[model samples]
Target: MQRIRAFRARSTPDRPAPLRRAAAPAVAALALLLPATLSGCAAFGGERSGIVVTTNILGDITRSVVGDEADVTVLMQPNANPHSFGVSAQQAAELEEAELLVYNGLGLEEGVLRNVEAAEQAGTPSLEVAAGIDPLDFAEGESAGQPDPHFWTDPVRTGEAVDLIADAIVEQVGGIDEDRVRASADEYRGEVEALHAEAEERFAALPEERRKLVTDHHVFGYLADRYGFEVIGAVVPSGTTLASPSSADLKSLSDAVRDAGVPAVFADSAQPDRLTRVMAEEADLEIEVVPLFTESLTGEDGDAPTYLDMARYNTGAIADALAE
Candidate 1:
C-alpha cells in the first residue's frame, strides 16, 4: 500500500528581504509618477488587458494562435512547477479583467484555481483548455478516477487545444482579426501535428519491452496512452507534485521497478531529483534518472522554451534512455 501526502505543499523560491527593500524605493518613485489605480497594478504584477494564461505551456500555444492579434500575458514563469505556482494580487485582478482567460483546468493549477474561479465569476471570457480536450483519469494512483489535467503531454491533444483557443479568441476577444487568428492557429496546429508525427517515429524504434516508464509522478499518462508506453510506476504515486510519497510508496515503486527492469526513471526538470534518485537506489538496480521537461517550459536559454521543443526533447530523451 502507498501512503500519500494529503496536505503537502511544494516549496517555492522566496525573494530575499534585501531585494524587497531595494525595490521599495523604486516602487515608491514609480508610484508617484503613475495614477493610483495603475500604481496598484504595477505593485502586484502589472495589469494585463489582453489574454491571460495560467501556465507557460498554454501561454506559448496561445501566443502562437494569437500571433500579434492581441496581447498575451502568461502568469506562470518559465521552469516553475504549475502545481505550486501562485499569482499576485494584481495578476488576480488582471485575470478578472482579461479579454480571455485561458487555463489548464481539471486541477492542474492547484495554487491559482480559486483565482481562476473568481475570474469566471467576474464574467471574464474564459477557456479551460484541458477539459475541452478528451481528458483521461488516473488509472492507478491516489488521484485515481479524477480527470488528468496534463493533456498537453499528448501533442495531438495540444493541437486540438490550438483550435479551441483560436475559436475562443475569435468569438470572445474584441477588435481582433478573426481570419488572422484562424490562419495563425492553422499554421501552429500543423507544427504541433508534425511534432506528434516526429514523436511517433522516434518512439516506434524502441523495442516493445523497453517502452516502459517510471517517473517522478504520474505526469506522462497522456503521453503513454498516445505512444503505447506502459507507466509501471512513479516515485510519487500521485497526479500532482505537491503530493509526497511515504516509505511504503517508495518500497512499492522500487519493487515494481525491479520487477519491470526499466532502464531509467524520468524526473521533471522543474523538480529536484532527490526522490527519484532514492527510488532508483531502492530498486537496487543500476537505473538512470533522466530529467524531462514534463510540467513546465524553461527560459529561452534552456532546452525547452516552446511547446514543440519540449515535446521533441522529451521524446528524444526517453527514446535514448530506453535504447541504452
Candidate 2:
C-alpha cells in the first residue's frame, strides 16, 4: 500500500514555529478573513441534500439507494481508470463543500487516497462501500501479490456493497425517508441473488471442459470462487494495472493457457484488450477476446450503464459464453 500524508483544506503548509513567529500577524489576518463557519463543513448546497460518491461504482450504488431524493455527483467518471488519477484544487474544494461522500475501498483507489484524506479533514463524512466484503486473494502467483480489490466480479459480494451503501446514505441524510432507499436496495439485492442462482444452474449444465476462464488481467477471482470456474491464467499477471507481467511470466501464462485448452481471454470493457490479443497470438491458439462490464459501468445511454443493469447483462454474457 502507498503511504499518503494527511492534508487540511486551506491550511498553511507545515513549517517550523520559529518561522511561524515572524508570520504571526499575517496568519492571524488570514484566519479572520475566512470566518470559522465558512472554513468548517456544514450542510451542503442546502440544509437537506443527499450524497456525493467518489468512484464510479460507488456512485452507481448511491444512486440506487438515494433514488431522486438526493443530488449526486461522482468524482471519478466512466472510462477513467482510477490507477492513474490525480486530484486538483477545484475537486478538493468540491469535497470540502459536499454533504456526504462514498468511495470503494480495499486499496482500489490508492491514487485518490490523498484527496480522500483531505475530504475527511475538511469534515466531509465518507463511507467505503466495499468495507465488509471479502476481497479475493491474489492468485496469479507471487508477483501478483497485491490484494485483489475487484469484489464486484461476484454478484453476492456486490450485493453486500449495496447494503453498506444504503446504510451509509440513511446515516448521513438523517430521516429523508429510507423507504425508497431500503426498498430499492432490497429489490436489487434480490435480483443479484436470483442472478447468482441462474448462473449456478447454467454453469452446472456446462460440460466440465468449458469451465475454465482466461482473461487479459487478473480479475474475476471472486467470480471463479463463487461459481466453481477454474481460472487458468491471465496475460497481465497482476491484480491491478499498476503492475506489469515479465517475459517469463508471459511464457508461463501461455503455457498454462495451452495446457488447460482455454478458448478465450475476457477483458474489462473499460480497459483496452491489446494485451489479451497479444497473448492469444503468442499462444498460437484460437483464443477469443471478449469484453464485459467489470470495472466500471457504461455511459448512461449505453447497455449495462447502471449497476442493476450490469448485473443482468454480465449474467447473460457469462452464461452465453461458458454454458455448454
Candidate 3:
C-alpha cells in the first residue's frame, strides 16, 4: 500500500518561472477585462451551489456520493481529455465560489490544475482524490518513478477513493446529511468491489501469453498491474496525451507490437487515434486498433456515460479483443 498523505486543503506551489512570466501579461489583461465582461454576462450572479469537479470521472463519482445533498458541477465535458481541456473564465470563477473543489491531482488535469490552485488560493477547500489512494508509478521511460494519475483504471483503488471522497464531502461541504453521504459511499464502494471482481474473473479467463497491452500511451499501468497484463509498449511512452511520439518511439513500439503478436492496440476514445493507426500501419501487421474509454466519460447516450459503465465497457472490450 502506498503511504496515504493526510488530505490538505491548501494552495499548491507557484507555477514555474517561465509559465508565470508567460501568463503574467495574459493574467493582467484578463484582470483588467474580467470585471466588465463578467458583469455583462452575469458570470458571478447565480448562486454558487454544490461541489465543483475538474474532471468528468470524478464528477460522476462525486455525484454518486453526494446524491441530492449538493449539486455537482463538472468542468470537463463528456468525452474530453483531462490533460488538455481548459476551463472557461466563468467556470474558473465558479470554482472559486464552490462549496468544495475535487480534482485528480498527481498532475492529471494539467490544463485545469492552475485553475484549481487559484480556487484554493481564494479559500475554497480542494481535494486531490489521488492523494488518498495508493498510486502506481510509471514503470519505464521518461515518466518512470512519477506517481501515475490514472488510478481509476484499477477498480479496487477507485473503491478506496470513494471512501476518501465521501469523507471529504461529508466533512467539507456544509449542511449535508453526514449519514446519507456515508451510506451512499458505502453503497458505491460495494458496487466498485463487484466491478473489480467481475473484471478480474473476465481477465483471468484470458491466457497468460495473450495478456499483453499496447496502447496509444502509457495509460493502463494500474489496469495491467491489477489484471496481470504485460504492457508491451505504448506509442507515446508517457502518461499524458500532451506528449507526442517521436519517430524512434514509434518504430520501437511498432516492433514491440509485432514481436508480441498483440492482437489489438487500444486508444482513448476521447482522443484521435491517429498515432495508434499510424503505428499499426508501420507494423504492417493485421492488428486491430480498439478505442477504449480510458480517460473520460462520453455523453449520456454514448456507451461510457458513467464511471461504472466506462469500466465495464472497457473490461468487456479488452476481454473480447485479447481473449480470442
The window of 10 residues in a row where model 3 has the poorest summed lDDT is 34-43
Local distance difference test, per candidate? 0.81, 0.67, 0.80
Off by over 4 Å in 1: 1-48
Q: What is the lDDT of residue 232 in candidate 2?
A: 90
Q: After superposition, how far is residue 296 of candidate 1 from its true place, in Å?
A: 0.7
lDDT of 3 by residue, 66-166 (tens): 89998899999998888899989999998878767788888898998878767755545566777557677789767877778899999999998898788
lDDT of 2 by residue, 168-217 (tens): 66666654678888998898788778877876777778687888988767
Worst 10 residues of 1 by lDDT: 14-23
Instruction: Report the Cα lDDT for residue 52, model 3.
Output: 87
Model 2 clash pairs are none
Runs in model 3 lying further than 4 Å from the true structure = 1-49
Per-residue lDDT, model 1, residue 231, is 93
Model 1, position 20: C-alpha lDDT score: 9
**Candidate 3, overall lDDT?**
0.80
Candidate 3, number of clashes:
0
Ten contiguous residues with the weakest lDDT in model 2: 14-23
Provide the RMSD of all predictions against the true structure, rounded to 1 decimal: 12.7, 9.2, 9.4
User: Can you give the TM-score per candidate against the true fold?
Assistant: 0.85, 0.80, 0.85
